[model samples]
Target: EAEVAQSPRYKITEKSQAVAFWCDPISGHATLYWYRQILGQGPELLVQFQDESVVDDSQLPKDRFSAERLKGVDSTLKIQPAELGDSAMYLCASAGALNTEAFFGQGTRLTVV
Candidate 1:
């Protein structure tokens, strides 16, 4: 069975440090998304991409966070000068097409001091 791949399942960093997370979606899936999930709240879309082109990123904090899918496949999300509020689960999901079923990766849990 195919699955989304995420690396460094856990991360801990002090405030003001930098951190990064990576994800590789299931093969042939075109729409990819990154979400931030607080412990008690539902996931929030951070960014969305379709074939290397950013489709939505209004929620992404451009000053401290950035995401990229350079080749329209795997993707990376980075946070510079991480803050305590940045602690949460970063999830990666992909879908073969719009309105199709989406698969989610085991999210990366980040902790900031």
Candidate 2:
């Protein structure tokens, strides 16, 4: 069985510094999603991809954040000039067209120091 993969279970960065996180979605899944989870709050959708096309990114902060899924399987999220308020758990997940269960990878806990 394929699984989502994320790097650096924990990350510490200085305020206003650049940071990046990576994810590999499950094989054969066409939809991939990135989410941000703040302490004590439910995860919120950041962006989503269907194949190589962006399906929804209305919640993404284009002014400070960007993401890409090249070839439609793996993806990267980047934040330039991170701020103290950017600290959160970044989660990667994917679901098949017929599968409703969104499988999440162990998230990268980002801390802006």
Best by TM-score: 1
Residue-level lDDT for 41 in candidate 2: 100
lDDT of 1 by residue, 1-113 (tens): 99999988999999999999999999999999999999999999999999899999999999999999999999999999899999999999999998999899999999999
Error of 1 at 90 (Å): 0.2
Measured with C-alpha atoms, the lDDT of residue 49 in candidate 1 is 99
lDDT of 2 by residue, 4-98 (tens): 99997999999989999999988888899999999999999999999988999999999999999989988999999899999999999998873
Clashes of each: 0, 0
- Top candidate on lDDT is 1
Q: List the candidates' TM-scores in order.
A: 0.98, 0.95
Give lDDT per model, in order: 0.98, 0.93
Q: Which pairs, if any, clash in model 2?
A: none
Q: Cα lDDT of model 2 overall?
A: 0.93
For model 1, the stretches where C-alpha displacement exceeds 4 angstroms are: none
Q: Which ten residues in a row have the lowest lDDT in candidate 1?
A: 98-107
